[model samples]
Target chain A: MIGAIATAIIQATLVSAVYALIAIGFTMIFGVAGVLNLAHGALLMAGAYVYGIVVMRNIVPSMTYHPAVGVIAGIVVVAILSLLLYELLVRWVEDNVVITFLSTVILAVASTEFLVWIFGGQNIRISLIEGQFALANARVAYYEAIGFAVSWIAIALLWFYVTQTDDGRSILATSMSERGAQLTGVNIRMVRAKTWIIAGALAGLGGMFLGFDSGLSPLMWLNPLAVAFIAVVVGGIGSIKGSVAGAYLIGFIEQITVELIGNGFRGMPTLILLVGFLLFMPQGLFGREFAHE
Target chain B: MPVLQLEDVDVSYGKTQALRNVSLEVEEGEIVGVIGPNGAGKTTMLDSIAGYKEYSGSITYDGTEVSETSSGKLVNDGLVYCTEDRDLFPYFTVHENLQMGAQFRSDDGAVQESFDFVYDLFPRLDERRDQEAQTMSGGEQQMLALGRALMSDPDVLMLDEPTLGLAPVIIDDISEALERLQDEGLTILLVEQNSTFALRHAERLYLLEQGSIELSGTADELRDDDYIRDAYVGVT
Candidate 1:
């Protein structure tokens, strides 16, 4: 029983790390742009496909397939795609939430279809790390360990960027009040575009990590997307810290439920928790009441 | 030559015209006041000048045509507008709020200079610099708003109702600060609903009514005008 509990705890931490990585980008896009980017899942799929083509194709040869290069390529491709998304689609329809939602939905569908066309309808795998270790009577894959470290590092870097950098402060200012930002001579368009790019890159890195750990399929993004959306909403619609905490909360709930009941009921706890939070404590943990502003 | 000029400007919001063929100028280092009743196109005129509203007219600032310039560009060009609402970043500390005013400026030395200038102008803000803006009183918020505008080191400062919702003592303090800023060679175009305050401070005043300039004169000239006295100055 102790071993089983330890295993559940380890699994929860690993899973929560990945969820946090996936949900941070979604929360940021919503917080800064005030647009629910439904295409976020699609962007993750695009990143996975990009990684698949770059590393899994064997075009670079197994001897020369550097994981760093693959990750950078994935991030760069997604960042460029996100910038294009903002300029071409989001910028025009940003003020109207419904239109933004519809446009991003279309983009998501288009992206998924594009990926299917390019990569075919088969699952692809890229092994990031080659070993596993035992800890407290539970086994942990090297890939999962690396993913957890990367997620925390990324979160730390993002927090520093947002709190310490001038451009990041400008983004916070714009999120607070567009008119106020304008009066201060902040180029709001540039801020918005940069925010989307950062979000896309983060999503891409997350996809790469997830694909390396569990393999990738065209439809893999959907579940993670749902998980991220629930995390964002449960944490608080626009709070980064809330999103992270919410991700861990969901992750632990899922792992504990799976350990106690079974895989069939794994999703039930998160669903219930989401509903409870939405109904009772809408602000989520660490979320401010004026987050919408 | 005037530092700013508005020639025959007209602004409309949908079908309702907010400003009609309004023309005005602000000479360098002068305090020009615009006073009018509510809905008299006073705020609309400032909005048009600040590029927040669309208008059909020529607006020239510092010899450049600024009718098409965005508000962000206008601020970088040294024209700053402090709106009546005091649209501050409420979550930020007073110091951070002031820092935002100079976000686009590259010269750290100049930015620091402006910060010192503002702190000197309103020492109360310096005292509460670490406090969040939303926690302050209405008068302090107004002071922070003014200090924030000054932090941009604007060559031409446009103020809209800086004394609104403040106590009479606070109003006097703000009026004295404006006088000091004007003395320091800042070109100011002030819009106020308080006709008495405007007449006492402005070198020249424009009386706007129903989207048109009904009267324009020196402060002494308009203060004694019987119609102006009865209509705006609250003297029966």
Candidate 2:
């Protein structure tokens, strides 16, 4: 029983990090573009499926050379996909928030259904770094630990990019007051397009890691997207720090719940927490600045 | 040579005509004042020239046709319109806001020089470089807005309403700054409700009434007119 509890805690921590990456990118697009992209989940699925195909089929040729190539290919595939989507679909209806959101929902549902049709609704496993690590009295998978570490590094890098660079500063300005930014020569449209691409790429990375951790499935992205939305809402709409903090909190809660109760009731506690958060602290654990709007 | 010219420009918003056949010009090193009562198309005229509002006629700047040019390209070509509302990104520090002005400008030394120039123009902004812009007072935000335009190194600076919501002392300070820029041989297009302020600072003036130019003359000529005095000064 003690061993099972320990394993649940570790699994929860690993899963939380993956969710953090998705929430971070989603919150970023909301911050920069001021729209709720329901297609975000589909983008995540697409990334995972794309990466899965590349790694499984050795499409990149050099991916067989190293594990790092798999990561790079994953980023490139999602970026290209994101760019095309933005140019073709998202751009035309950008200013109309309602239309864009509906389009995103349509896109998410269609893409998910299409993938299930193609991949046959069965799980396809990926073995990027398949090994176990023993720490103290507990044995855990190396990929889980690696996923957590990669998430932290990615979040850190993203935070740095948003705060330290000129482009990042402009993006922040765009998030706050797009018209103001444009008056000062910010390429508002291009900035948003670039943001979508980056968000998609980050989602790709999260999906890639998730695929390696727990096999690729057409529907694997939905659960993570739900958790990501929870974290983003609990953290605050557009706040970076809030997203990270909320993710860790949610991750630990799930882990503890599974240990104390069971897997069947693991989701109930999160739902209750989310409801409580929305009722009392609707601004989020931080503030509206962190919330995705 | 006339550096900026708007010839028989007609502008509309949906169905309502905002500016009707409004024509104006500002020569190099000229401070051109535009005065009018409310809804006299003062802002509409400037917006038309700035490419924010579409106009039917031609807007030529520095001998180049600019009726169809985008605002970004026009800004890069050294025509900047400082918006009236004094909008600033609330989340950014004063320095960051200033840096955004130089987004298209790549020169480090020149950017630094412009930064220093703005600081010199408004020492209060330099004092609060790291502070968020939203925390500043209305006058300071106006100064920052003007400072932002200066960073673009624009050839013709069009100020919509620089003195709005500022204290009388700050308004004086802003007027002094505009005069200094004028002394530096910069062209300006001034739009203001306060005729006293405009007449004092500008070399030439246009009086706009209900979307049309009612009067055009040298500043001294407009300053002495009885009708102008009765309309603007509230003197019978």
Candidate 3:
């Protein structure tokens, strides 16, 4: 029982980290652009598929399913895809965020379905680093631990970048007021395009890590999408710290539900939590400033 | 040649004409004030020069036409517009807000130099360099807005209502800063509801009313006119 509890704690932390990575990207995009991209889930799916393709095609045959490679591939693939999206769709309709969001949804749904048609609906496992280690009486998967650590590192790096650097402060400024940003010579369009790319890369990386944690499947995007939505909504829109906190809150609750009730009931607690947050903290904990402004 | 000149400018928002036949100029190192009631096309005139709104007119700066450039590109050519209202990026630190003013400067050293120069003008910004802009006092934020414009190292700077809502002391501070900028050979075009303040800063002034330039002359001439004083300056 002690071992099971330890394993559960480890699992929750790992899962929360992954969720944070995904949620951070979503929050950044929404916060900066004031666009609720329903298609962010599609970006996640696309990243996982891209990784699966890259590995299967032996583009990097020497590369195994190492967490590092997954992360690198995830970030790179998502960044490229995000750039493509920016050049092709985002720039043309940035003024109409609602339309841009709807267009992204179409893009996501089409791409996801297309990938499913190409890769088949069945699960395809990326072979892990060959072995599992024992922690107490429970067996801890190496890939899982790696996933957890990589996600935390990514989140930390992002927080530092967003809060510390010149470019990051520009993003924070853009989130506050686009006109204000422009009056100060902040090339609002460029800032936004760069934001989309960063958000995509982070989402992609998170998806790749998630694929390693669980075997890739056609419906893979749904889980991350749900978690990201929950995280962003609960954490508050445009608040990075809030997103991270929300991720952990949802993560631990899901773990607790799975361990205590049943795997089938796990989603119920998340739903309840989301509903509760919406009812009580609709702006998400720190979003009150932006709620009316 | 004038530092900035607008010739027969026509600007419209869909079918609504915001500025019609608006022509004006600001000479080098001169503080030109534009005053009018609300909807007098004052903001539109500034917007047209900044490239935020399109206009059918010849806008020339230092003898170069500027109607074709974008707002960002215009800054590169040394045209800076300080918008009305405290439009500082609320989430950014005071230092970052100033840095944004130099976003187009490709030379890192020049950017750094500009930052220092702006800091010299607004030492309060340097004192609270790392604090988020929104948390600052209103006067500090206004100073930040002015400092941000100066950071672009512009040859001509346009200010739109630098003091809208603030304590009387803060207004005096803002007015002093504008005067100092004018004294240091920085050319400026100021738009304001405070006719007294505008007359105080500007050597020459234009009174706008209902999208037209109703009166234009030296500050002393406008101040001496009874009708101008009755309409703009309060009768004390």
Candidate 4:
């Protein structure tokens, strides 16, 4: 029983970091642009497939040199895709909340069909750093270790950007008060573009790690999307710190339940948490009203 | 030549007209005021100049067309608008708010000097640099807003309702700061609902009523006019 608890702790911590990455991007988009981005999960799936294709099939012979190439390619491809989505569609529909929401939902559903067309309906595997090592009582995979480390590095780098650099701080300022941002010479359109790129990069990294665990499929985005939704809502509507906190709490609860009960009950507890939060604490842990007309 | 000029300006919101055949100009290193009651299109005129409202007119600011530029780019060109809403990032510290005002400026030395100037101008803000903006009093917040705009080193400052909800003592502090700024040869286009406040500092005044310029003259001429004294002076 002690071993199970200890293993659950390790697993929970590892998974929570990845969830934090996903939820951070998710919440930042809503906070700044006021768009919920239902297409976020589809973008994550795109990242995984991009990594899988570059490393596994090697359709482009020149690009199959190293694992890092695949990683960069995955992240860059998704970032560009997100920018294209923004420039082409989102900028026009973003003013109307209902239209933006419906547009993203349609895009997400269309992406699933597009993925099935390209990769077929088969669940394809994407390998990263393989081999399991023992850490105290828990046996952890190299991929999980690398995922946890990289996730922290990304978070640290993001923290530095927002707090230390002017361009990045503009993003934070706009999230707080857009009119203030404009008064300070911060370009709203340019700020939105930067945010989409950053969010896409984060989703790419998280998706790459996620692909190693469950393999790649067109429909794989649904579960992570649902988890991100729960995490953001249970945490707070517009707070990045709340998203991180909620992700950790949900990850721990899910892992502990899986360890104590069974694998089938993995998602049951987080759903319960979401319902309880909505019913009792709708404002969430740190929810604050956004100033948008 | 005027530093800021608007020729035959017309502004509307959907079907309702806000300003009709409005014409005004502010010359270099002079103070001008637009005085009116609520919904007299005073704020709308400033908003149109700052790239917030749609206007059909020729607006030339420092030799560039206002309509052709984005609002943020206009700020870079030194057209700073200190709005009635204050529009501050409440979570940021007072010092951080000031930093944001000059975030896009390329001249480090000028920005540093402006920081010194703003701090000197508003010692209350200097005393509470680390405090969050949302926690400050209304007068202090107004000072911070004006100080933040000062950090931009603006060529022309357009102020909207700066003394709207402040104590008499706080108004004196703001008045002193404005006098100091005027002494430095800063060109300003002031908009006020408080007629006395406008009359106090503005050399030239334009009285706007029902979306048009109802009267225009020097401050003394307007003060002597019976209509001006009866309508605005008594109420505000």
- Return the top candidate by DockQ: 4
TM-score of each model, paired residue for residue: 0.94, 0.93, 0.92, 0.96
Identify the runs in model 4 with alpha carbons over 4 angstroms from their true place: A57-64, A291-293
Q: What is the per-residue lDDT of model 3 for residues A1-293, given as tens digits with 9 covering 90 to 100? A: 88789888878887898899889888888888877777777787777767766664333455446545655676788888877877887778867867987897788678768867877778877643557888767676777777777777777777787766667777877888888777767777788888888889888877877777776787788778889999988999888888899899889999989999989988788888899988987888767457214
In model 3 chain A, the worst 10-residue window by lDDT is A56-65
DockQ head-to-head 1 vs 4, winner: 4
lDDT for each candidate structure = 0.86, 0.82, 0.81, 0.89
Q: Report per-candidate DockQ.
A: 0.79, 0.56, 0.55, 0.83
Q: After superposition, how far is residue A134 of candidate 2 from its true place, in Å?
A: 3.5
Question: What value does the lDDT take at residue A77 in candidate 1?
Answer: 99
| Candidate 2 accuracy as lDDT | 0.82
Give the per-residue lDDT of model 2 (tens digit) for A1-293. Answer: 77776776777778888888888888878788777778788777777777666666533344353456767778888877877888898788978989998998888888878987877778887766778987644777887788889988988887788777777777777887776776777787778887887788888888888888777787776777777888878998877677777888888898888778887887778788889988999878767443222
Better candidate by lDDT, 1 or 2: 1
Query: What is the iRMSD of the candidate numbered 1?
Result: 0.8
The candidate, 1 or 3, that scores higher on DockQ is 1
Instruction: Estimate the lDDT of model 1.
Output: 0.86
lDDT of 3 at A275: 93
Better of 2 and 4 by lDDT: 4
